[model samples]
Target: MKILIIEDEIALQQSIAESLEKENFLVETAADYHSAVEKVFVYQYDCILLDIMLPKGSGLDILEELKKVGKAENVIIISAKDSLDDKLKGLELGADDYLTKPFHLAELNARVKAVLRRKNQQGKNTIELRNTVLDLNERQFFVNDKNIPLNRKEFDILNYFLLNKKRLVTKTGLAEHVWGDNSDQADNLDFVYYQIKNLRKKLQEAQAEIEIESTYGIGYKLIEK
Candidate 1:
């Protein structure tokens, strides 16, 4: 999963980013409001860790902007304030959960997982479509109950495909989600093409009931056989 951390405290932001990265999530950060707004406008994330307090603006405003634009990333409000109003206001603006400062990173991770489960995975740890299963926690994939081992990028791409099954996945969106947004600096996405080709070959060899269909010069979609 991809996560965006909107925080101004340098140490805390770095700590949270490092923790999520260790958890094998693609992590991105913005210390202030404008950059955070820009990111939400451009990219989609599985979840967003938002701080109530931000430089040049408040995180609540950011939530409002996201709603206005129809961005549905699960949001977890992280703040030092313990006020009920602040919590209520955030929830009203579409936050999935709130965490006060001086809390454990483990707890934060648990909350993130819970929100992702409830919203994205329908409260399940495994995603199943036809005969294929993608295990979120174990980072495993199975075809007809047989293990289909995958490297990190391949797994990420497959996960995204299953999550969006049958929906057109643009190349830019795929690159940004599986690779970091910074990957756009590369000269080409030949790397992405190679990865998809390799993964598709594996699925076919396994006789899996799913196929990744490509739209020439556009994108790809996951379809069941």
Candidate 2:
């Protein structure tokens, strides 16, 4: 999953990003309000970790922007303020959960997963399409109740495809989703092709009901076989 961390505190921001990355989450950061607004408008994320106080603007306004466009789904507000009004107001504006500052990274991670489950996965840990099941918690894939082993990148790529089934997924988007910002430094995305090839072979060998169709010069689309 991808997460946006909107925080002005440099140390805390880096800490949060590192912790989330260890959990295999593609994380992006916005140190100030302007940057945060830009990312929120430009990309889609599984969840957003929002800080109430920003450098130039209140984070509440960001939430308002999200709600206005109906892209507001999984948002967990993290702030230093513990006022009841802030908590109530944030929830009223559609935040999934609120965490006060001085929180453990483990707790934040747990909250992010919970929100992704409740909002994106419909309160379930697994996402099912036809006979294929991807377990979000266990990080496992199953076909016809048989577990299919997958490497880390393979699992991330497959998870990205399943999340965007049948949609036009560009190679750039796939790279960013699986490898985060570091993918931009790669000399080429030839590695992506090889990984998908391996994943496809495994699925075919297992007689999976889904196929990842190529879009020629574009990327791929996961469809029913």
Candidate 3:
């Protein structure tokens, strides 16, 4: 899943991003309200970890703006404020969960997973499609009950396609989602092609009925027969 963290604490933000990245999530950050607003407006995220207290503006405003745009992006408020009023107001403004400051990173990670599970996985950890089964926690794929080994990039590529199944995903979108900021300096998308090819080969070898369609000059689509 893709996540946007709107926190003014640089150290904490970096820590959160790193932790989520290690968990195979596409993560981005915004230190203030304007950047957060811009990100939420332009890009789509499965969830947002927003700090109630920011430098330029309150994170509550960002939540309000998301609601105004009719964007149903799941939001979790993270702040030092432990007041019941703040929690109630944030929940009223559509926050999914609240995390107070000085909390454990592991606890924060758990909360994020809980919110995403409710939002996308319907509270399940495994994602099953066609003959393929993906273990979200283990980051493993199985076909016909046989485990398939996949490199990190290949696994992430497959996960991305599964997440957006039957949708046209551009090369740019794939790069951004998988490689993130580093993709900006990439001159060619041959790496993406290579990774997709590897993933497709593995799925085919396993007799999985899923296929990825290359959209010529565009991108790819995961099609399941």
Candidate 4:
């Protein structure tokens, strides 16, 4: 999953980013209100961790802007304010959940998973595509009731495609999502080609009939047969 973290505290922001990255999530961060607004306007995210207090503006304003524009991005408010009015207001403004400051990273992680489940996965940990089932918690794939082995990158690629099924994902988008922003400076996208090829082979070998169609000059799309 891809996440946008809007927090002003540099230390806490980096910590949250690192922890989410370790869970195999594509994480992007914004340190202040304007940057956060720009990112939300430009890119899509599965979820957003928004801080109630920001350097230039309040996170509530950001949430209000999103709602004004009809953006359905799932938002979880992370704030130091524990007032009932604050919580109610956030929820009223379409915040999916709220977590106070000084909470455990593990707890935050669990809440993230919960919100993702409720928002994207239909409150389930497993995602069922046409011929495959993906166990998000275990990072495993099953086909025809049998487990299929996939390397980390292969799994990441497959999971990303599955999550974005039927969407035309550009090569640049895939590279940035899977390999991070540093991929933009690479000399070649051979790594992406290799990973997609490997993932295709693994699924085919597992008797899964899914296919990824290359868009020639564009990117790829997972097509269900």
Candidate 5:
């Protein structure tokens, strides 16, 4: 899964990013309000860890902006403030959950998993569709009950496809989601094509019931056979 950490505390932000990355999640961060706004506007994330206190603005404003723009990325508010009004306000602004700071990292990880399960994975650790299984916790993929070895990029591509199944996923969208914002600087989408090709081959070899169909001149779609 992809996560954005919007925090002003550099140490806390980096620590959270490292921990999430260790769990095989793609993580990006912003230390202030403006950068956070820019990221949310440009890229997509499975979830966001929003800190209420920031350098330029309140995280409440960020949540409000997300609501205004109709962006539905699951948000979990992380703040040092423990006031009931702050918590209620954050929830009212559409944050999926709230995590009080000075908490355990393990607890935070569990909360993130819970939110992702509720918001993105249909409240399950494994995403099962069309004879394929993606085990989010294990970072493993299976087809017909057989394990399929996949490189990191291939797994990320497959995960993205499963999330958007049947919807047209533009190459640019895929790149930004899986490869992060740096993909915006790439000269061509050949890398995305290559990853998809490899992922398709693996799935076919395993006799998986899903196919990544090219949209031609546009993007690709995941279709169940």
Candidate 6:
């Protein structure tokens, strides 16, 4: 999954980004409101960690903008303020959950997983599509009740494809979603093709019901076989 951390505190923001990245999530960060706004308008994320107090812009305003654009990214407000009004306002503005500062990182991680489960897997621990079942908690994949071994990148790629099944996924988007911001430094996306090829082989060997189709000059799409 991809996550954006909109926080003005550089240390806290980096910590959160590192934590999420360790959990195999692609993480991007914005230190101020303008950068956050720019990121939201330019890219898509599975979830957003929004800090209400920002430099030069309020997180509430960002939330309002998200609502206006109809971006359905699940947001969790992390603010130092513990007031009910703040919580209520954030919730009313479409935040999935709220976490106060001085909270444990473990708690934050759990909440993030819970929100993702609710948003992507309908509050279930597993994601099922066709004959494939992904155990979100365990990070395991099963096809026809048999476990399919996949490397980390392969799993990430497959999970991304499942999350956006049938949608046209660009090579750049796929790269960024898995490799994070570092993908931008690459001169070519030929590595993406290699990953896809390996993943396809695994799926074919397992007789999986889904397939990843190339869109000529565009990217790839996940479809049922």
lDDT of 5: 0.82
Model 1, C-alpha of 209: deviation from truth (Å): 0.5
Q: Write the per-residue lDDT of candidate 1 for residues 1-225, one digit (tens) a residue.
A: 999999999999999999889879999999999999999889889999999889999999999888887764599988874455777788888887777776667557756765676585556889888899999899999999999999999998998787667767767667755774355577988888999999999999999999999999978989999
Provide the RMSD of all predictions against the true structure, rounded to 1 decimal.
14.1, 13.0, 13.3, 13.3, 14.4, 13.4
Alpha carbon RMSD to native, model 5: 14.4
Residue 44, candidate 5: C-alpha displacement in angstroms: 0.3
lDDT of 3 by residue, 1-225 (tens): 899998988999999999989989999999988888889999999889988888888877778878888764578888763455776788888887776666666556656765675576666777789889988799999998899999988887887777667767778667755774466678899989989988888988899989899999988989997
TM-score for each model: 0.54, 0.54, 0.54, 0.54, 0.54, 0.54
State, as a TM-score between 0 and 1, how close model 4 is to the true structure: 0.54
Model 4 misses residue 70 by how many Å? 2.4
lDDT of 6 at 122: 60
Clash number by candidate, in order: 0, 0, 0, 0, 0, 0
Clashing pairs in 5: none
Q: Candidate 6, residues 61-170: lDDT per residue as tens digits?
A: 99988988887459988887445577678788789877777555655675677578668656677778899998878889999999999989999888877766776777
Model 6 stretches astray by more than 4 angstroms: 1-55, 58-73, 76-120
Span of 10 residues, lowest total lDDT, candidate 4: 175-184
Give candidate 5's error at residue 87 in angstroms: 1.2
lDDT of 4 by residue, 67-124 (tens): 8887745898888734547766888999977776766675577567756765755567
lDDT of 6 at 71: 76
The lowest-lDDT stretch of 10 consecutive residues in candidate 1 is 175-184
